[model samples]
Target: MDKINLLVTISIIIIFIALFLSLFLLTVKTAHKLSNRLFAFFLVLTAIDISANLGDLLAISLNMRIFISSFFFLQLPTFYLYVLSVCYSDFKLKRKHLIHGVTFLIANLVLLPRFYAVDEDSKISFLANIKSMPEIQFNHVLMHIQMLFYLVAAFMILRKARKIYLENYAGASIESLNWLFQFTVALSAFYFIALVKNIFKFTEYPNISAGLKIGLVLFELIIIFWYLYKALNNPGLFRTIDSKLKLVQDIILEEKNSNQFTINEKEHSEELLKLQHYMMEEKPFLSSSLTIQDISVAIEIPVRDLSLLINHTLEQHFYDFVNAYRIESAMDILKDSTKSKLTILEILYDVGFNSKSSFNTAFKKHTGYTPTYYRKML
Candidate 1:
């Protein structure tokens, strides 16, 4: 097929896949209903945005084109909201979120006077002179600025959420968090390339612009397929953190500044000993879904104190702290001659690691060898 036909065919497939994913997200029976809905909406917006690629082939009218293009304003904001929803379990669709659509409203207002309110002949004339229109220029600039802002904000949220996950949850949760982080990074890279493509569009090099556009479509196609593979392989990929949870560092800083919380050296040592005893004797780390709050309750320590003890005094994240014990337990099993028949998978699950990949990673990090290599040496 010709280049235009190939591009159009790819765009059509992307739209179909995007819509299919959106429908699946909307209807999927998941704990993160709100997050799924937000993401579904974002996907729908994406499909609409991609539909613009078909304008010429479909003989799309100017008004219809304008309507479809207007959704561009909502796309990134919806994505931003989806990021927020994924990060925070308590996230809800608040009335204040409507403010995100202000740019869309403004874009429509800008078009009203020049294009939308005019007749077909006038609209075509306006389109011919669109490059010189200040309104079009302003909207283009605004769109780019909004994309930059939302992409940055989404990244910051993901970074903070990952840190919080490390400080509060166990190692098993890392895979899901890493998946989300990868998704955000991929989207960010896509947006950056799209920005570059937009810049090239105004340059004299039409061929370069077209090449970038094709590359973007191909990049997007890969992302969707990768997402599908991940989603199908790991049905429980999404995990949420309580929005009210504070970072351990933030808690420590606040306590130090306000002098509202203090622990003497003796008390700190006592708590550390207590935590260690419980971890050793009770083996609380055996629970794959363990959290710092669970440890606090089991050891009769305050959550804040537990956070401070493991995250601050021990100089280790709660995740690493728990995983350390689990790794130790797995090591003991590996060393035992009586348990020679126990497979690495069996040992991993017995020691609270739900995923073999996480177990292998933690074991290798702790022992400088993969579980298989470590076992073979013995």
Candidate 2:
């Protein structure tokens, strides 16, 4: 067709492909299957909603076009549920949650008789009339109202979840799914703008609605592709929230971020001793992903002060300080007669070193000999 229609058609095709890829990767590759499955369901609802628009653009038959309005009300609930799945560790799509989609179901049921009554020739007329019906008009208004409510609710959940996560384990390498937050914000803005424009018919231009639809299609395509790229690269992006850790981390982050604490030199040395005692007792270095931030949180010292003590007082960088403990731990494992059956790789992993090369390098740096050589000598 024309350039505008061509762009819409291309965007539709790209979105379809992107949706398939996203669903496939999210279902197969992700760690937390439940959350990813929920996300995939959201994408499916989005695809159905967009497909209805594409059907209108293609002048698809009345049978296909008549039901397009029925799918419109499901988008917000699906999105909100998806957000719930990601942010809550124990979220389950219970029967009660299906109440959110009750309006969609009722709307579709009410239209079913009309859908069958309209023939192919009169389908467009039927669709036009359906839109004008008092009930349908009410539903249309209600859809936007529902959208506004759910948008706010979903954002509140996400913001709270993210805040909790950062407070507890700012140093953890867990995927935060911040993209979903951005997506929801963008979607809310797009829908709000569309609602306002439609209500006011703000444009004098005859074709502005078509242009807006095309622009929305383009924006959705961008979001879909970005989602696909991230899903493929980071399969664990939708993993379940660590609620317990988040709670604890929030407490720690609050304490750390607070400005009320101070330390004199004597207290600094005392805190340093406490750090040493905790390190020796807890051996948090056994976690490969441990960070100075994690340590600082655990020790209840400011990260800056902890870094100063490790780097200046102990004459070691944070990484070196942690690795020094890991290497030492590995040596103990190697030297222990009862642990003689453990493999070098196993020993390395046990002490929190993720790779053999790093373990070997650290071991050699500390002991002036390779692990295997040291073990053999022992």
Candidate 3:
């Protein structure tokens, strides 16, 4: 009815909508089934928490209120496990995971008579006389401590995961987890603010406490909306850990192969010759976005074999190896007097260099002179 209540109600409603959409998106949009399922269940728990908060605000029935509040202890652990799921490629929900539900069970048992068995009016009276009960204050303190522990643990998981990712993949892309990290950090800030607000509750500066509480709610609402926008646009954000692990494995295998000679050196050498022939004839590198994977497929060689041939045998990275052929082609075009009328840009384009700067740089690197200077010398 009042502005403050209206604001709170609106924010809660938005959070509800976000939870629902996030659940649906996590299940239907994302391909990472295991992690997605875990995250979806986490959202379900969060929705239950929000429902409990709504029930309390609306002064709902005592039994229903206590049932919802019992879920409070389950939220942090579920979320902490979700972060682990996101990080570890082999993560699975084991039997030991039920330990996380212990607090919820205990909370429900302890609240059996205090809140759950009471009538609606008596429940409201109990909430009003909360200061008379030290147990409620203790529960709040324990919840804050649990929340802080999991927040730090989640960060540690991500930090370790990031290190593993970089060590395994030479060209590893962190784009998928980058937004997730932002959301995690924002959520941590929300928890920190709530903790501080509770600590300074009875202080003279009530405005600071009120402002932080309000800020935390607003922070949550804004992030949920941002998440919705990101989810819609970047459905690949939750790619399977298996897929990520496979990529890392491929890179590591390639690197290892580069260190040792293949047993079938004759066959591999033949393949390398064929690969060079294929590149010269096919000119796949002309495509600006060419990757080792693409060339490997075209040349009918395993990506690791191709990487080994290029890096160890030829002593060049894939990009440089391809660019060398492109430069050689450009040189041929430059030396051909029949194409004297063609502009240097035209020659670069015809030879498959995508941009002028790239053409100039590659030309200089290979030829010791810029395209214009080389053409002038001719």
Candidate 4:
């Protein structure tokens, strides 16, 4: 088969996979129901967009192809909402979310007078000289603008989620946040390539445009497979942060500027010593799912004060502060001759680490050696 025919076949397979995954996400039993549904909707919209690329191969009518193209405006917005849902546990679809559909509505309205209101023959003719059609140009511009806006918004949400996760929690949650961040980065790269492909579509070089289209189909196939692997192998890969949680830096800055707030260096130092003593004696870091709030209540310190002491005064993220203790505990156990027979996994679990990868990372970061290597040196 010719390359175009091969790409068309691959596109068909990708569309099927996307749809199948969408169905799976929609029906899968999980705590992240809203996130799953939003992601499922995003996949359905992606499948529709991919199907639009097969219009010529499928012998779809010009008007139908144009209608299918309008769905592109919704794809990025749906993805942005999915990112929000995954990042914030408290995210709920409200009336304000409908604003995301504005571009889709406007695109359809643009086509209403020019293409959708006309006969099939007129649509064919209009598509024949689509380069000259103002409505078509306007819709293309709108699609690019919407893509840029939503991609930026999605990335901002992921960044904020990462900061919040680092400041408020510890353990394998960072791995899940990193996975989501990497996925968003991959999708952003894909969108960038798609943008280039769209730009190439209007160029004089048909070969480059066709090549980009084929490349995009292959990339989409790989991305879908990657998604399936992560979804199946790591079903619990995404953990949510409360949307109400503010970054420690923001809270510190707000307090610093507030006239009602005053610095008590002596009291702060006492609290720091108390916190360190509590950490060492109580060993609350032994909880894999430990949070700043948990520490706050245990030590009778307010959450805000604890955050300030750990994040601002100590200049350490809550995640790192907690993991430091866990790593230190693991190191002592590793050095003990009595625990020589214990596996690295056992030590990690005993020290409150949920994932071996995270444990190894923290170990290496703290001691400049892997857990096994550190244990062997003893």
**Structural similarity to truth (TM-score) of each candidate:** 0.96, 0.62, 0.61, 0.96
Candidate 1: how many backbone clashes? 0
- lDDT (10s digit) by residue, model 4, range 1-378: 488687878889999999999999988899999988988888888888888767556677666787787888898898889888888889999999999999999999988886888888887788788877898888889888888888888889888998888888995767877887788788888888888887878878767878888888898899889988988998877888889989987886787688546679999989999899999999999999899999899889998888878887888999999999999999899888998899998999999998999998888999999998887888
Higher-scoring candidate on lDDT, 2 or 4: 4
1 or 2, which is superior by lDDT?
1
lDDT of 3 at 2: 55
Cα RMSD for predicted model 4? 1.5
lDDT of 3 by residue, 1-378 (tens): 354675568557765775787668565844466666776676666666655435336675566776776676887788888777766667888999999887778767666677767777877787787655565776677778788888888887776565444332222124445556787888888788878987766466777876776666677677667867876776655542332433334555675689854357898779888987888788876665566667778878886666656765666655567678878888888889998889988877776655576578778999899989998999
By TM-score, is 1 or 3 better?
1
RMSD (Cα, Å) for all candidates, in order, is 1.5, 10.3, 8.3, 1.5
Over 4 Å off in model 2, which ranges?
Answer: 1-4, 56-64, 109-126, 129-131, 171-177, 200-206, 242-276, 279-378
Model 4 CA lDDT for position 15 = 92
- Candidate 1, which segments miss by more than 4 Å at Cα? none
Q: How well does candidate 3 match the true structure, expressed as C-alpha RMSD?
A: 8.3
Ranking by lDDT: 1, 4, 2, 3
What is candidate 2's TM-score against the reference? Answer: 0.62
Candidate 4 residue spans exceeding 4 A from truth? 56-61
Q: Scored by CA lDDT, what does every candidate get? A: 0.87, 0.70, 0.68, 0.86
